[model samples]
Target: MAEITLVEAVNQALAREMSDNKNVLVLGEDVGIDGGVFRATAGLLDKFGDERVLDTPLSETLIGGVSIGMAAQGLIPVAEIQFMGFACSTIDQILNHAARIRNRTRGRLTCPMVLRAPFGGGIRAPEHHSESTEALFAHIPGLRVVIPSSPERAYGLLLASIRNPDPVVFLEPKRIYRLVKQEVPDNGEALPLDVCFIIRPGNDVTIVTWGAMTHDSLVAADKLAEQGISAEVIDVATLKPLDIETISVSVEKTGRCVIVHEAPLSGGWGAEISARLAEHNLFNLLAPIKRVTGYDTVMPLFRLEDQYMPSTDRIVGAVNEVLKFE
Candidate 1:
């Protein structure tokens, strides 16, 4: 295992998958010569050349549309939208076509493709550059949504997504792209989907989260210890087919739950989680599940953006509220 950044892990996964599968192809705006917006695709184009690692026009609608056609025809096409917000442009293709392709074909044709995007705020990127849109994709019947919290999980899950027969929306946490680092397996790592990682083990409260919010959740857990609360932080690697068993175990032990995310409070993934907890463990609950999430407003511009993103203070406050219920 070697210490690496999220960007490095993503590049390594792409490189290894392409080497193993001749049919694996990558395409997106600035992906080929420019190495992608975050350089996650850097050096891939040079290795695979223009045909395999393509740089398409700046039209997400066409990118998803074309990738669907390629995947249906047997090419494992991985299309990257510039950002999660830009992915909205491809909804027509994704919702009406890519997602429904295999079902529409009744198992004859498969949309075994991966839609990749860097999502969520924290690097002070421009508006529309960071959005946690995973829930939207998860709500689609035939689509799989995944968001890896660290370098190792990123590499493992990317490989899994590429190998899956169904369509996948792979969301990378943009905030920790270059900011966080960890030791990642060089190769030969196959992490299964539908599993959750207990990033930190504790007994007081369970903090469930994914993407960049996982990093903040851990920091908040550490602070909570200073205040005499032992918080368990669960880093969710897959968004769809959520590891409810793992979450239920932690929540059952802790008797309190605080969910964290960068998306707005309304209609976000947190709502789904909260509903699940209420359904599975309401009798075991010591406190009503709380959420530390973005404001119920648009992704704010630079000026007051800090107010729109989740922070350690916000997370701890939510946890404290749950703690009081105990």
Candidate 2:
């Protein structure tokens, strides 16, 4: 095992998958010779050659459509959209076609494709490069929305996404792409999808989050620990088809919950988790569920990015508020 950044782990997974399975191919703008805008696909072209590592035109719609066609025809296509903000053009193909193919064909065909995009704010990126609208895709049926928080999860989950028999939206938190390093094995093994990973265990409160927010939640958990607050931190790696059982069980133990995310508060996935808790574990709550999320507004420019995203302070504050009830 070698220590690597989240983005490097992603590149390793892609390389391993493409090497292990001839059916897996990478296609996207600047993915080949240029090795991708962020170099997540770096060195792939040299290892896999031009045939497997294709550089498509600068049209996300075309990329989405071609990927759908390839997946329906038995190829496992891993298409990359430079940024989540630019993926709007590919929504038609993803929602209407790629996602609905299997159900529409009544099992005659399956769309085994992974749409990769770097999402979230930070890195001083301009507009159209720092969006975190994952909930939009999570709302769509027949799609698995997966986000990785750490290098190990990035490596394992990405491999699982590519091998999934259905279409998946693999969102990478660019904010933490190189923020931290962790040891990840290059064993070609895939982690289970639609599951949550508990980062820290405690009995005081459950803090649920994913992507870049997970880092802040962990930090807040540690800080709260110093103040005698035992916070249980959970990384909801798979946003869609959420592993509600894990979350509900944790909340049931703590009897308090705080949901966090970088996406705006309105209609974010945090609300979905809250709803699940309210429905299934209403009696388990010792306090009202609190949400520490970004404001319900457009992600601001880099200058105010910190104010817009949920921070360690915000998470700890939310936990304090919930703890107050008891």
Candidate 3:
């Protein structure tokens, strides 16, 4: 029950799984000797030895191919891409082989692999270091895209992803990796996948978000509370196979909805959620759905990072806009 940050919680989950399951192997660039670029895999190599914790070449394609090969042959591989921006290089293997293996083999085989990467902007990282292109994987059929906003969720969701019998893209928000800490129990309990968690209960508006945006959304909720506005916050932990029912139910009660994300506005996952609400819960809304999101441009460098990312002011403003519909 030690207090740990999101990154440490991730390390705890990997260690627990690797210790409990001998077939679980960790592979990625600088994962072994270097303990990963963020040190999420720190100390794993020494505890599990080189055979279990392997250090691969700095090639995302090779890492994807090798993990898929290992998974098909009965080994459960948890592969890590150095950064979300670099994950595009491995999309071919992921979209083709890894995602289609179960259907291609007609249930004879399952791809139990977890692809982990740190994503989003805020840490003043250089180009190709910060990317929130989660929508790409979420659009792909048969792939489960999961993002955790807190240390507790990171621990549980990651364990669940590795145990899942399908390919899963586990994106970690690096900005919040060590921003907060929580006393997460190291009991090896895996949380449910494809579900949304209600972070706060309210009746005025439903605020939907995931990953690092959850932090700002919660902060906005608090600010709105001071002004006598009740905002319900929903953390869409499992982006793929989205739990729209949970969101729909919340929107029904709140009568207003505001979606938020760090990804650009055009094709962010927030659009899909907005579309679903309109399709199934159109009559229940009191106002048009609003989305507070990043601009449709490349993530800027350190100087402009703060402006590029959505802030509490934007979220509160969206809530206020929706509340005016009545």
lDDT of each: 0.89, 0.95, 0.95
- Model 2 scores a C-alpha lDDT of 0.95
lDDT comparing candidate 1 with the true structure: 0.89
Backbone N/Cα/C clashes per model: 0, 0, 0
Identify the runs in model 1 with alpha carbons over 4 angstroms from their true place: none
Segments of candidate 3 deviating more than 4 angstroms: none
> What TM-score, to 2 decimals, does candidate 2 have?
0.99
lDDT of 2 by residue, 1-326 (tens): 66899999999999999999999999999999899999999999999999889999889999999998899899999999999999999999999999999999998988999999999999998888998999999999999999999999999999999999999999999989999999898999899999999999999999999999999999999999999999999999999989999999999899999999999998999999999999988998999999998898888999999999998999999999999996
Alpha carbon lDDT of residue 245, candidate 3? 98
Candidate 3 per-residue lDDT, tens place, 1-326, comes to 56899999999999999999999999999999889999999999999999899999779999999999899889999999999999998999999989999999997877899999999998887898988999999999999999999999999999999999999999999999999999999999999999999999998999999999999999999999999999999999999989999999999998999999999999899999999999989999999999999999988887998899999999999999999998
Q: Which stretch of 10 consecutive residues in model 1 shows the poorest summed lDDT?
A: 185-194
Q: Lowest lDDT 10-mer window, candidate 3?
A: 122-131
Clashing pairs in 1: none
TM-score of 1: 0.97
1 versus 2: better lDDT goes to: 2
